[model samples]
Target: MTKSIEAMWKEGFVNEACLTAPKINDLYNRKSQNIVDKFKDMFDINIKAVIAGSLIMLIMMSFIGAPFLGIYIFCLLIPLIIIAKMELKKSVNLSKGQSSYDYLMNFNCWLESSIETYSGYYKVFYPLFFLGMAVQGIVSQAGGKLISLLVEVLPTDIIILGQPYYLVVAVVIVTLIFARSAEAIYRWDLNIVYGRQFKKLAELIADMEELRK
Candidate 1:
């Protein structure tokens, strides 16, 4: 005549009086721990993917004859991995010895904090990334030949820092636009990569909150 945990959970949900305080607390802990464990696994996978992507980018850039740009991007990527690892470390220790509700709350706060931190970095990073690409394009062999063709056909008088003034202005404008849209771009990226995980986390938090009421 012992009830299964699932039956107890259902019974508790239907009529709270059927479950003791310890049983309810244990169920909450189990549910939250399952969600948190899944999140941790996904986070680890995401970090690994980023590290792999950075290596691929470096190799591709080097093969494409943009060693300086490759190095620059590699350096930029290092900090991203570092920051993610740091956040992961913090998350690992975040909810130790805390109740299920408190643990979920801490996780929610950590997610918000992590997103804000990454968004700030991406805001600066996106503009710089575009600018670097622009510089590499203009200084490449093809760019030199194209410049020569333009010089033959168009007026060579419109120069700024030995480059075409219009080209410089265009690069600057494009970079500015990217900077302005960086947050939206980051959100889009996040949605593409981890939208389901985030949705599940939000739902788990909401359920926990409702259970506490």
Candidate 2:
């Protein structure tokens, strides 16, 4: 039964490829195939959101003495991650063969379903995410100040090796590196997926061009 399902999927893919082959070729030859812009915009939005939220959290942590702020940020992030995965799946499905019109419809349907499914959770999630960042900033600042005070009391020798100021600096540097790395990974994954889809589209176009000749 699994084999049959696989075969059916392959057959559908082939049929869709054949049907869209000419259109795909035309789109490619137009010298304005800037579909990457669309994908880039989507990625940019997510990056901006994450960065902005993280900065807010950092500020809050600096001022407050609450670890719960970090927890709240994590909680809000969970739903965003879920939404992102859903969007990725929809994009993959659309790239596979669905027409833009159909893809839009399907995407909207999925979005609606997701909203309904997570409505109750989001009501709590968004506010917490925002509040958490505020709290995190406060806590982080407080933590930094506390460490500075501790360092001040330590022997000058110990201060040279592992001062609280140094620790705080290290943490900031590490956080920035991690954020950049995460963005890079996301971009790489997106490029790999888009490259494969484009290659397949190109092959279909070549076949259609040959047939036309």
Candidate 3:
């Protein structure tokens, strides 16, 4: 009855391979968690840097007679930071007991949504930022003198209603061109900042998927 006993043992006994499934899943969980933790760390640093830079710019602008530029940029960025911080909190609070793959997928979706949201904001902010700089330049001490000099040299045909229509047209055109490419520019900037972390996350997800198969 040895063959019968062997068959019964095979049917009833658990093996090392069976036990390994949970360990493998746990490993994936840890790896996925690490990837997300790294992203959060990077994001936190960026936020702090933005805050410090804004304060520095405000102080420098106050000294240089362009405090409005500093205030304008701060106002534009503060609301964005507030919204992002709230979203970050929500991501961190995702329900427990999710599969590693599902968690990563959720995070990926969140990242894409965040990028799109920021891109929408950039569409308006980028144009206003450029336009504001143009205005700042025109009103600066050196810029005011330079414009006066140019006004004396320019033809009256280009000056309409006592305003330099050509300069206005040039500024608007440049701002429009920059605005048109703002999303691409922001994506490029994001890639530069987070490319390595994003690549690791994708690779980890692929590995987990392959293991499942």
Q: Largest lDDT belongs to which candidate? A: 1
lDDT of 2 at 202: 49
TM-scores for candidates 1 onward, in order: 0.83, 0.35, 0.84
lDDT of 2 by residue, 1-213 (tens): 344644443343345454434454344433222443344356557656665675677567546655466555655666666666665555455342544333434444553454454454554554444444433443566756776676677524434224444554555565555444554544465457555644544454454344333
Which candidate number would show the highest TM-score if scored against the true structure?
A: 3
lDDT of each: 0.81, 0.50, 0.77
Per-residue error for 64 in candidate 2, Å, reads: 3.8
In terms of lDDT, model 1 sits at 0.81
Give me candidate 2's TM-score against the actual structure. 0.35
Error of 1 at 95 (Å): 2.2
Q: Which ten residues in a row have the lowest lDDT in candidate 1?
A: 13-22
lDDT by residue for model 1 (1-213), tens: 897766555556445455544577677778778878887888899899889988998999889889899888888878888888988888898855866778878888988898898899899889998988888878999988887787777766789977877778888999999999999999999899778878877887787666554
Expressed as tens digits, the lDDT of each residue in 1-213 for candidate 3 is 344643333322223134434555566678888888899888888878878887887889888889999898878778667766866776787654676677888888887887788788888778888988888998788887887888789855676434588888888899998899889988899899999988998898777665554
Better of 1 and 2 by TM-score: 1
Candidate 3: stretches off by over 4 Å = 1-18, 158-162
Superposed by TM-score, candidate 1 places the C-alpha of residue 135 at a distance from the truth, in angstroms, of: 0.7
Count of backbone collisions within predicted model 3? 0
Q: Tell me, what's the RMSD of every candidate?
A: 4.3, 14.0, 5.9
